[model samples]
Target: MTNNDIFKKLRVALKLRDDDIVKILSLVDFRISKSELGAFFRKEDHPKYMECGDQILRNFLNGLVIHLRGPRPEKTNNKPQKKSNN
Candidate 1:
């Protein structure tokens, strides 16, 4: 229903710990502290409960992509060689 809900479910399903999540987020150049991450998992009624934002969710999804599939390879230019008749 909510971003926090979705994030919580995914984290459980993926069996990811706080550190693992931090690493995954880092893969996409998104930085999140462990304490901030913990807030997302807190109960809704809890004082430290923090709603997950679109940017954070989007970055997590992007980072998950890189984490699972590995980073894309860099492209290089290579000119075709001319053939000579023997």
Candidate 2:
């Protein structure tokens, strides 16, 4: 299936509205206008239909991950590095 198809399916499965998608994408620092986002969901034959790019899909997935699972905790470095002799 095309990226558009996958995107459309995910939108339906998640029951995400245009605003929700905008927020989800923002989580990953990806900014997309509602009009642009709407283009992705348009019918293929429509004049305004825009093909979904890999970058957009990838960022959406990353954002979705953060949406479903909270942000990853910061790593703690308990071991100190040893000093090297010159």
Candidate 3:
């Protein structure tokens, strides 16, 4: 399954709104906009990630698992491109 599809399914399963997702991600130190999240959900691809850009599916799956399974020690193999903390 695609990242977007997985994300949508997870969100539905969790019964979370976009705002709720934003809040949850904030708790984990990952900030993203609702529009971006919507785009990710609407599109057939995962949104670009600052910490796991190269690992699109992995990044999304990790996020879903974290949301469902709660926070855990992060495991990242590939370095991600740095984005300015705007």
lDDT of 2: 0.97
- The runs of at least 3 residues in candidate 3 whose Cα sits more than 4 Å from the true structure, single-residue gaps closed, are 43-86
The regions of model 2 sitting more than 4 angstroms off are 80-86
The sequence of per-residue lDDT tens digits that candidate 2 reaches over residues 34-60 is 999999999999999999999999999
Report the C-alpha lDDT of model 3 over 1-86, residue by residue, as the tens digit. 65556667877987889887777666556777887666766543445532223344455555666777787877888878899998
Clashes of each: 0, 0, 0
Q: TM-scores for all candidates?
A: 0.85, 0.89, 0.53
* Candidates ranked, most accurate by TM-score first: 2, 1, 3
Q: Show the colliding residue pairs in model 1.
A: none
Question: For residues 1-86, could you state the per-residue lDDT of candidate 1 as single tens digits?
Answer: 99999999999999999999999999988899999999999999999999999999999999999999999888976888889999
Candidate 1: regions farther than 4 A off: 76-86
The model with the greatest lDDT is 2
Q: Rank order by lDDT, top first?
A: 2, 1, 3
lDDT of 1 at 10: 96
Query: Cα deviation in Å at residue 12, candidate 1?
Result: 0.5
Worst 10 residues of 2 by lDDT: 69-78
lDDT of 3 at 82: 92
